[model samples]
Target: MSQLPKASLKLFPCTIGGEINYSIPEGVKMEILECRNFIVENERTARRFLKALDRNFPLEETQMSLLNKHSREQEIPLMLKALEQGNDVGILSESGCPAVGDPGALVVAMAHKKGYQVKPFTGPSSFLLALMASGLNGQQFAFHGYLPVQENEKIKSLKYLENESKAKNQTQLFMETPYRNIKFLAFILKTLNPSTFLCVASNLSCEDEYVRTMTVQDWRKTELPDIHKKPTVFLLQS
Candidate 1:
């Protein structure tokens, strides 16, 4: 195979939540096989995903540069250096699209700043999937990664998002730490207006995936699921 010229960085998105074999596509698998260098959130997670795509792929041969929360500060320098060497690289997040809610954004921005191309591949995204099934204003929506950990701040932010959704006729989307899902749901039910619409999407792309939209009033009557420790996305629109 002839050496390909210096090309755009590939942003490969893995499934948000599910079995990799069923969720990942052949094209994505090909992309994974093509790249020998990658900037991943976690080397172990990336290796496992690549193995799921192809059991025989040489995991030890691939060069992976970590870009998680702890290593983020040092990643750009290394990633840029690799790109400058005319090597095509892939950015892999633990779940969903790289840089969407992940730490890979900084590297992507640097790639753009250096005038290097950055290409995003097709894949699952919890927020987009949730918005599609949300029955809310997808045309105008926002994704606030995580809510405040404190009770008072969480309530205040919920009220603002609810009001913003109602007044501007836009969808307001957000997420919480898996363990905090139940508590977050409770806060949404308590803070938002009774008429406001709320959508809870959990374990997306998984066998037990759940995405439901309902009014705050109606949600009060419905029993909350055990979303603890499950990847979940929440949306609100009035």
Candidate 2:
């Protein structure tokens, strides 16, 4: 008799901020307890999250495969092999939801191509959270991920996103390196129209969480918060 295939890979979402502040669902916890094979962005963070969920859980014995921006393409075969052998696998990211604004997306794509089922659990997502509170056009929004590193190129991209927003009434969303958040904010205030609506959601879900939407002109007048080295999401509505 042939062995039946195991259930689909579980795409688990970790906390964007402090795990203590946002609890993982009990259903996901039970799922974790039943999964031994996992593909994670960072083994250390994944293990830490699992331990936090259940202190008595044995992490050392679990089989872990690291997947990150630098992950090798060859690693996909091994992970798929584990799944083909009737073993359910878990995909995790360092923070927030996996496969969304994360490198784990590559693995998830491969799973789909190979006819593996994927199950995603509900969790905190900074992008969606910021949009929900942005008071912008959430129905029509586009996330441009990280802005260009070069100032000139970045400015050009920003201008394009701004004009596109005006033309289509779309909400333009993007992010920057935490350390460069203040600088990026400064650039936005200087480049975009003063009346443009901007939302800066920083340190989401944390005690020091800040989510403010205001006109670029108003933002320039207010005292800017210290967002250096912090996770932030930016949104604009023209």
Candidate 3:
């Protein structure tokens, strides 16, 4: 059999989402895999995580190169190729676990549908973290991936979510592209009632992490740090 250049995939969470970034000590020689590729947004979370693991590239590349016209057209193909090549992979996220508002969802989803073993090693998930922190409720929380992009659709969805939150007392978790987090906050302010409690779990499990629980009215006055491009998770409790 011919020997192939070794490559591996690893999924580590953003700095705010897991302990993998902070656990690596000074000099620990462990090179079981030939190559490692990390997929994450361009920000502190991703950078710090890699730094802690002491990954140097050409040594490590990002999956962003697979994006085709803002769509991950090549994600599945590349992942399949890697898996087929006998490379043990790690599919990581900028925040939370991989496949949850992260780049590796398509690949993981496909892996499952195709009868592949999809074993997962997870860290903190902002959705569950927020639910655990919020006093409103936790027994029943619905993780709504993201708000609708269209204006009218967003409005309608917000109204429905608000009512559902009120009736069920279930936490509703949502997020936006970190840069547009403020825009999503503004939308919440404009759509939800003033008294509704909103929890903005930005940079979870990190030094500058903020788990602020306040109402829409308070959010209006509170000087929130420009969490733009940061790994942010937003939650609403009515």
How do the predictions measure up, each by TM-score?
Answer: 0.94, 0.96, 0.68
| Model 2 agreement with the true structure over 60-125: per-residue lDDT tens digits | 778998888988777887876778878889988898889999888888888888899889988888
Query: Where is model 3 poorest over a 10-residue stretch in terms of lDDT?
Result: 24-33
Against the reference, the lDDT scores of all candidates come to 0.86, 0.87, 0.63
Candidate number achieving the greatest TM-score relative to the actual structure: 2
Ranking, TM-score, top scorer first: 2, 1, 3
Which lDDT tens digits does candidate 1 get at residues 1-238?
Answer: 6675867789998877687766667888798788888999988888888887788988777888889777655558777676766778899999988999988988888888889988988888888888998888889988898988888998899999988887888899899999978878897898888998899999988999899999999999999988899999999998
lDDT of 3 by residue, 1-238 (tens): 7876554344444434446545322221133122354344444555555555655633335433232125565456665565567655555455556676655767666666755555555466766666676665777888887778888998898888788989998788877877888777777788889998888877766667667788989988878667777767677778
Tell me how far the alpha carbon of residue 139 in candidate 1 is from the true structure, in angstroms, after superposition. Answer: 1.1
Model 1: pairs clashing at backbone N, Cα or C within 3 Å: none
Report the number of the highest-lDDT candidate: 2
Model 1 Cα shift for residue 83 (angstroms)? 2.3
